[model samples]
Target: MTSSGIARPAGGAARAVTRTLSDDPLGGTVRRTVLPSGLRVLTEAIPAMRSVSFGIWVAVGSRDETGPQAGAAHFLEHLLFKGTNKRGALEISSEIEAVGGETNAFTTKEYTCYYARVLDEDLPLAIDVMCDLVADSVLAAPDVETERGVILEEIAMHDDEPGDEVHDLFARAVYGDHPLGRLISGTEETVTPMTRRQIQSFYRRRYTAPQIVIAAAGNLDHAAVVKLVRQALRGTPLDTDPAAPAPHRSATPAVRTRPAATVVEPKETEQAHVILGCPGIDRLDERRFALGVLNNVLGGGMSSRLFQEIREQRGLAYSVYSYASQYADSGLFAVYAGCAPGKVDEVLDLTRAELARVAATGITEAELARGKGMSKGSFVLGLEDTGSRMSRLAKGELLYGNLMPVDELLARVDAVTLDDVNALAADLLGRPMSLAVVGPFDESAFAAR
Candidate 1:
């Protein structure tokens, strides 16, 4: 689809093919090009703005690790910034900061992203610095040792926060020994004993061209961005052969039956954080739109059922919400509440009752309309910034292998009817739940109740 002087080309080996994915009057034109190196570069051009968000997405994460390799993906994320072949860590940070920009990276269950935001004029610098970090990190022994302590401290920091710790505990309770259950930052037990050799091996094996996508948005030209990327990635041994890109490695851990179980972590805290959830659909499930609407109506906002019932009407908790976490093949649907330690049982009962109510009777037409509107507004308002748009493009390519325009995505959300929500709720929320609680109590405290 050609618009605004950008021509679309058919896919080929010798030449990069450009295609427009979307032409939203509010979000600007989205485009993508597959370079000969097997690296996919996606961009959303918004000439109305002056800043750009650029990101390098790698299709590997904690789930890709072996038992002994736990936390290696996260470790490599830190090391990449320590020093590349051309610049040291301080230079990498100062160069971006000098231009009043931000640079950072994060690791998720299924992917890792290194990203930067800079003035549009500084786009080339951003691209060069990020590509260098991805393709030419030294991963020196001394730097590895230093970052190891930093990662361990991060793990410690996470443990000290009970509210955040409970989510990881909840994942463990839900998925058991599966890699999906492990923490992205890993534990002190895992990080403290890791070796540099293990980390370097992970970087070499997982950070390949075929598994990488470079996404950028905001005031930029698609051709210019592609040229900058091509230059930045030159001399790297990226596979450019005629064969199709390498298939992503799968972490197909066996699925286990959902059991009604609870894991209590005794911490000396005034408030308890608990998560109650059941199995959910995978990332590519068609019912995800219905599930999204259901989540919003159930507890996504302050106006949601859980918030209105537990917070506004009963005053049982301070923070309460429901969420869905989707992976490549599996997912979790959960509700979290932070309340007084003494009120744990009351909160759980209320949450369970609400879930049962939704499953049995479904939602009203008013709730369905509100859910769709909220989901649509959130999706559109979120993309007003370049970072969110860049993230959208990257995820669309890495996860789904196509870019879904804003209008098309909204259409899917709008298509969900009350019947769709009821069917999904009945199927997902009716399953047995696994509970996790972090508070000043033991397992017997819950069992006695």
Candidate 2:
């Protein structure tokens, strides 16, 4: 039941089996052990480093929620820190900070993670605190109500920032009423009416052992981590067969949907923010490496086509970039820009022209080399922190079902040829565009253009 390429021994006592994922000199050794409880534990040993990052990842998020449970996943993230059976909210923060450590959690569209980083010597404390919070949170009625207002204010704060709000508007324009289109922090309408019982029910249903992974990196031993985790989760009854790893795909396959459209939100702002994009490839698509290369050259940085053309050449925008978001079944490729309200049309036109040009002729050889170099540099630099390593292991296990070596990932990026980028550009960029704009103008402002 383990992922492909990992060997699992047959018929053993309720224990963990370990396997090495990577032994790179630069990144250290990554090992994975699937606990009998179906909770996969992954760790990377970097003896040279003094800090360790521990994370508990759940494979459920806002997209897994029903309409009535819109913000339950994010809401529970807040409640988990309020108090566990043995520790109060203030105690939780004090314990971590007492050791000069940091603890936090974030909920995304597809998953949620609670993590802590501390000196390697204090790894045991970090693991115990995080596991206690995850396993034994007391979702008190008062705490739930207090957090509800906090979440509502978070929503209002996000609303005030049009630059940030426009991306949600873009997702709505592209995905329509689908779960992917909804905000991670459910709207005021959804959160205001949510009850404690509903939030607790959502937590019990989604926070099961089979859907969780524990990841650690930096100055650690595989066996020691497994022992600590086993002791930490000793009393909790895990609903899993002791003999097998959890099934990889538990939930039904996500429905893929894409609709080309435009959504404009009129607001009084100093500048107009717009996103021009279209549907893109999913996480498992083999062509993603090519897409990454294309994205880098197109709008990934200051030297990218969008940035150079819009900001450096034309001075139409102060900030402009392109990014791609990939999920289990669907994805999005977008170019975003913030400009003077009067320059919206020109910005859109120029952005469209760049897209068309790249789609038709593809990028130059110089662009291809530069894109690969940038991708490689960023990839390596990003993993220098223990937190990034822990994140990479958790995501690889939960999403890809295997941990790909750092060199292997770079090879995939390097293998992307000019033809690959060109072909991807011709296909992905040639699709119809969905535009989202947030400014003080009506739809009529863009109708004639």
Candidate 3:
């Protein structure tokens, strides 16, 4: 829906290449137009394939939920499919399936998206159906009552999984009371109180045309897609503009209390699930590429420090990995491991030791080069899928404000020197780490280093 503020493009070499200026033709080829009512349209043509994927991204999520309205965005996503003016849930499913296509939707902290993939000839129908779901979901009384229980059960299910609990724990320690840490599904107390009127008010106030972004990929023509979007969203009342989000302030470092007083089950699960992390870079940070390379060396793949030490050498756990999940303004760099109940201490010690080792000594050239190769390879591999390509485009729109070509991304990875990776590790993972362990382990094990 807007320009993807992607960096300059690069050459066709599989290895990362530095660029003088971007060689991207897609920058010029991408077209943007706005309707009288405030709907923004963005289009690009991918001539290599015969299929088309039309996406509608709305800028409201659980983070946008006001007091007592948590999980409203996710609940609203389910209700959208239950019924609309033109079709009921069953009919909608049958219609899309008859044409050998598929439809789905997802909810996140910043957006809700409904997308469909179909043959190019069915692009108009796909657009119509998606727009209807967004602008016209019938939050019927019975459906609301029905979905409340479903969401409640979903919340309960997450509570039973140690990995899931530790994730929430890490978010709580990092974000404190900020909306960024709020659970998407919400608690029973908050979601049970939601009413049909509340859902309607939120939908009307936030789902405006100006805040909606439609991204399509595949063999669709640019002009035809522009026409289809313009026609489908013509009559909806685009009467409101979203209020600007609050400025983000980094959360003060906190040592969280364990789940001792709160009710929790799964105390006897065989493997312990640990989510140890620290606050890292934001999505818009220029050094995000360096952080990516750092993560790869630490625990990103099979050869990573955490994996090789915890799993391969000691045989303490079946799975161990490190990752970074960056959002609009901040991010989390974490190490997750599933270990034998008796070996939780060993796994935790190894993880912390590896983090400290990297911070103190930094990485060698071989480690940096290998990490760069892995990061660049993963980037290229992700581009092969149509859904991933569409997702990458949407991420660029929402984050950097432009779609970064694969070539440019590779170059950035290539440019990350050993010094860059070491600096990032020292900046992010070198401090006292926030710990979240979910299992039959004692909190004393996490007493600060």
Candidate 4:
């Protein structure tokens, strides 16, 4: 993929500039446009597709919140859909459903996304509703109170799922008081007393046009989608004084502060959920592709080492996997297993032994090839839908500031030599690890084990 000219408005007035970021060897094309207000719009046009996935990706998330503002980003997500100046909650859903489309939003550690998937012909409606909800939400008081109850219940639901809660506990065990380690949904303590004014302030301060990217993928024209977005946001708060788009998030050295080495939440569950890991590389690390390959070899799938030994061989655990979470400036890599409370020690031991073996001797050539193949195939197969494509456009602009083509990405994975994977494994997996466990045991349960 290569690009040509970027036509900025002649006078740099209250207008927009357009650029062709890339053109696939095939007929596919990806484009980027910067609005006068600094809001960005990126799109990939796939003419053969019959549906469109359009989204508004805000660069603010739970990590942007203060202690008192924990979950404020997520709170605003629910409130935005509750009602906007131009549409009520019922109208918002009914309008999308009327066209056989679906809409939803999710908040993460560093960003939030509100999206709609609809028939190609319904792009205009989808664009308008999304823009309105994102930029013109009234954030009424009554809606805040109502959504507060909803979010509290959501938090409760998350707590009941130990499998999911274990991951959050692992994060805390590694990062401690860092914002990145906090729960995205905040706890009942933070959410209960959080005031509407606090959330509203965060909304206005961080939800600026400069920090947002609007992306869409479908059988559509770039210019028309840009026009629709500009029109929808014409008089809203987002279309204010002209400014340049915000640069991608900056990275800083994340300090771990020697967080608790072991965190166990005593519960009465039949199965014990645990994660053993250490801090890993950042998203921009040059070794990321190698790490992906190494992850697959370690515990990425059913054929992975951990899964085969833990589940298929000894039947010590019903589920086992390893995953890496990368953020702008920091990351964590961990192995997780859910097993009978009695077998927790055995599972942990096997996981540690496997991790140590990989770190010491590295993966074989055969294992390396399989790992690379798995990594490449998963990356390509994941983009077989409009939603994933749309997400690629948004994330490219919001996180990396440039789009890497599918072929280039695959090539990166293939370029992972055995040396690369082994070096990363030695450096990453050789580090001291922390452990988090949630099960029917006292805090001292894992103290000895």
- RMSDs, each prediction? 3.2, 2.1, 7.5, 1.8
Over the stretch 280-342, how does candidate 3's per-residue lDDT look in tens digits? 777777888888888888898999888888888888888899888777666778898988877
With candidate 4 superimposed using the best TM-score fit, by how many Å does residue 309's alpha carbon deviate from the native? Answer: 0.8
Q: Which portions of model 3 show Cα errors greater than 4 Å?
A: 1-29, 239-266, 442-449
Q: How many clashes (backbone N, Cα, C below 3 Å) per candidate?
A: 0, 0, 5, 0
Instruction: List the global CA lDDT of all models.
Output: 0.88, 0.89, 0.72, 0.90
lDDT of 4 by residue, 1-449 (tens): 22212335567556677789878763369998887788989899999999999999999988888888889999999999988888999999999999999999999999999999999999999999999999999899999999999999999999999999999999988888888889999999999998888888888999999999999998989999999998999989898887888888877655453544999998899999999999998888889999999999999999999999999999999899999999988889999999999999999999999999999999999999999999988887888889999999899888877888888888898888999998999999899899999999877877775
Report residue 391 deviation for candidate 2 (angstroms). 0.6
List model 1 lDDT by residue over 214-284, tens digit each. Answer: 99999999999999998887876454442233444432553563467789999999999999998898888
What shift in Å separates residue 265 of candidate 3 from its native position after superposition? 7.9
* Cα misplacement distance, residue 323 of candidate 4 (Å): 0.1
In candidate 1, residue 75 scores what lDDT? 95
Residue 148 lDDT (model 3): 85
lDDT of 2 by residue, 1-449 (tens): 23522334575456566788788877888888877767889999999899999999998889888887888899999999999888999999999999999999999988999999999999999998999999878899999999999999999999999999999999998887788899999999999999998988888888888789999999999899988988888786443556444444432465555667878999999999999999888898899999989999999998999998999999999999999998888889999999999998899999999999999999999999999999999999999999999999999888877777888889999999999999999999999999999999888777754
Q: Could you tell me the TM-score of candidate 3?
A: 0.87
Q: Determine which window of 10 residues in candidate 4 has minimal summed lDDT.
A: 1-10
